[model samples]
Target: MTTTAVEHGPTMNTTATAVPRSSVGLVPATATLARQKISAAIRSGDVIFAVFGPVVFFLCFYTPLHRQFELGGGDYAQFLTPIILLQAGLFTAITATETAGQDARAGVHERMMSLPIPRVAPFLGRMAWVVVRMVLTLGGGLAIGCALGFRFQGTIVETFSFVLLVVVFGSALSMVTDAIGTVARNSVSIASVLMIPQLILVMESTGLVAAQAFPDWVQPFVRNQPMSVYADTLRALASGSAVEPLAVLLWSVALLAIGVTAIVVAGRAQVKR
Candidate 1:
């Protein structure tokens, strides 16, 4: 009787809503972002730069240097082709600065942080363009080099090695430059600053001239520097001659380590805002 007289209380709903898993995976997000970057590069004439940058550089170097190299009993086209391929990678790195700077200025990274997709997707997307640009530039550079009498005297494996070396160096350089672009306040200024070192390294390297070609005082720096080592290694690969593979491997590893370090440091240094 007392229970019946008690006032009835309202029922509380105990049903819980299941949280949904994310529909977008990291791979798809990275691919989508990469496509976006590639498209932007196309719209901005970056594609043209990728294909023609090496062509212009090749002509500039070869036109003046060919007779000189030939006079010295060497084919400049063969001697110089490897460096042009490597420079294509350098060009790619420089271009990455502008695009990465644009993204930083646009608040794209901040927007990305709010999404469920992996944060690294956007960076990986930008790197995909680096590979594409390097490839395009390599192809164009090779075509021009071949037209000018550059030939691969190496076996298929060595030729492949030659190519792999160029791409790897370019990729490492791109990674460093891209990270710089992302973190630097003024990417265009960064590019200009890099150009000086680029010119110095290429000009002083055995790629453009023999170690003996430089003055005795600078020869020590010119002969053993990283660019010179890379140039010498690439020449060996193209000529099907033996080189210290361990040295090239060490250089590659060092370059890659520097690149990865740059990316990680830049990511940590980046402001999510």
Candidate 2:
């Protein structure tokens, strides 16, 4: 019997070593609570800012531009609709990262960390919330675009193309903004940091002056920036013109990659207390 037990022990040890351990991650209940809370908060504010803001901004442009530009078959408001949607989207893209910073400041993140939830919960949960807000915000903008006389130029195929472009690029911007928020020491810092991109990089330059009015370098960059491309695509869709679908797709993928890379780098820099 002793000899038999010794022979079996080697086999038992081999089997034990071969069976893999379960990868540690967020417990079901904790993950559920985190997702629910984040989703609810984003949905509320996201609708208000992304949808309502664009609606109001479009109304202001309708009357004045109606008399000015002879936009072929469409009015100035129609031309401006997609641009306004892009603008509204920018406002809500950073919602998640901003909320995460708030959580960190409030000790919520630390409290969650103390529980059995996976270390990635805080990061992934916030990103999920960002995506939710993006949908709400961008959906609202699309509704506003329809109200402002924007319509799909072609079949259902083209409509999907426009939405795909918007979502991808919007998500990229949101991710980049989230990374910035992660690195920001406090809420004030995050707000202050976004001012440059909000005021300068993203603010409307379309239809204001001739593209030639700017320096050669500035002209091309301004025209091809993410917001600019989205606006251009929106206008094309609304006017029943051929849109640059490939350019938008390329830009969207590139932006998402860049934003994700930045977030990972910033996350690694974070020191656990």
Candidate 3:
């Protein structure tokens, strides 16, 4: 009778298996991706272009124009430094459009979606790499500027502030281009679509020539456009004067919002496909 104990099935282990924590945060992961992107750019010779492009432009324009024209009563090269820096950022931003377009055309985004990583990681990674290139371009431009008699008339803080403004604006513009690239048919198409607007902005802005220099018909547009505002603010940062920083800030925010919306739309479209 006592031996009638029910046979026990396999006893379950009540110990909870601990889930291992991931050591990487978004910053580190994004940084790793940034490094990878930068390495790829270096391998592709993008670094060379980023470094030398501003130098060449500086040589071509600054050398010939410096003695002929004095802007704001200072050397033209000094006056042109801000614009040169801005141009470097612009050129670096172009890579974003090309790379994003290529990724979209190649179905790279689709493959990335299958991975365990965050969806935004790739985009942020590309942006981080863009910043790296921006820095390089800035450095190269500054070096060339220095070589060509461009000096910072402002204090060190002012110079740094000028750099910050340029980089931030460039980054905003890059995000806009990134979104455009995601939807564009190809890199060439992205370039074609962006070229006219960018050219207009650069050529008509107060960075290269005074707003007063523009024809009467175009002066109104040149004086009030976002690019003109940015160039004016940057010029002020260089030598100190009245500038419309608020306008540039608002414009940057608007561009960033548009870019984010475009990326979301493009991502949804990709998912549908």
Candidate 4:
């Protein structure tokens, strides 16, 4: 063929090359990714960080700190035992934000967007890790609590239900953090934004200090905050008393709603970028 003809033929062949078929967004075989993520979380100190607060809570009660107050039942360890679980939920959510930010910065999130895996898969995968991490931490907390003479006052089923409540809520909280991370652009912002409110409202004792003694102005809002509900539920669990089913349901739904809204907003921002 002449030079012009040769060039034209190759151009035609280039256009004729088929685009590879994309994978259907069917559920991915995510077992391997799940394992890898879980291993990484453990190796990266995520789980260890989750463990620290619980251990510290245990020790605080096991020491002179318990003498400062009645500690309800005079067994500060038991009182703090269930609270360790609340702390676990709080810690995982806070940590997930920074981790998610790192993943985004590393281009993992951007890369995933190019794939055919369902958009929800990444969130679900992270959520699965949240559960695994929370459960492992909860188990550790419980073990330490038991070792320190904190016994579950409820039936096995009741105890499991309480744990389930904590895990479900914790996962929802983690999703919120993930969405926040998507928009944070860096780790420091993530920490500053997510950690502060959590510490002040949840971990700190503005309302928890004196549930019945808060200032009238703060009482209304503090009573409705998730941490307050968490503390109450924990007290119930520790004492083997009935937990408020409605409170748990309401708080869980509220958190899930916030997370869902955040995810949708973050997804839009990500796509725009």
**Top-scoring candidate (lDDT):** 1
Candidate rank order under TM-score: 1, 3, 4, 2
Q: Which should have the higher TM-score, number 1 or number 3?
A: 1
Q: Residue 91, candidate 2: how far off, in angstroms?
A: 0.9
Model 4 bad stretches (over 4 Å): 1-29, 70-73, 203-223
Across 197-228, the per-residue lDDT of candidate 1 in tens digits comes to 88888888888888898899999998887788
- In order of lDDT, best first, we have 1, 3, 4, 2
In candidate 1, stretches whose alpha carbon ends up further than 4 angstroms from where it belongs are 1-23, 271-273
Question: Scored by CA lDDT, what does every candidate get?
Answer: 0.87, 0.64, 0.79, 0.73
Query: What local lDDT does model 4 show for residue 242?
Result: 78
Clashing pairs in 4: none
The model with the greater TM-score, 2 or 3, is: 3
Itemize residue pairs with steric clashes in candidate 2: none
Q: Estimate the TM-score for candidate 1.
A: 0.90
Per-residue CA lDDT of model 3 for 91-129, tens digit only, reads 766778998888888887887777656778778989998
Of candidate 2, the 10-residue stretch with the lowest lDDT total is 5-14
TM-score of each: 0.90, 0.75, 0.85, 0.82
Tens digit of per-residue lDDT, candidate 2, span 20-43? 545446656446765775666746
**Superposed Cα deviation of residue 215, candidate 4 (Å):** 6.0
The digit string of per-residue lDDT tens for model 4 on 1-273 reads 656543344434455777996764434525445666788887887777676667776675457655654544465556666667777787788878877787788888887777767776777777778888888778778888788677878877777777888898788888888898878868657667766777677544422254555667777777777777776776676668877879868888988899999999998988898
Question: Comparing 1 and 2 by TM-score, which wins?
Answer: 1
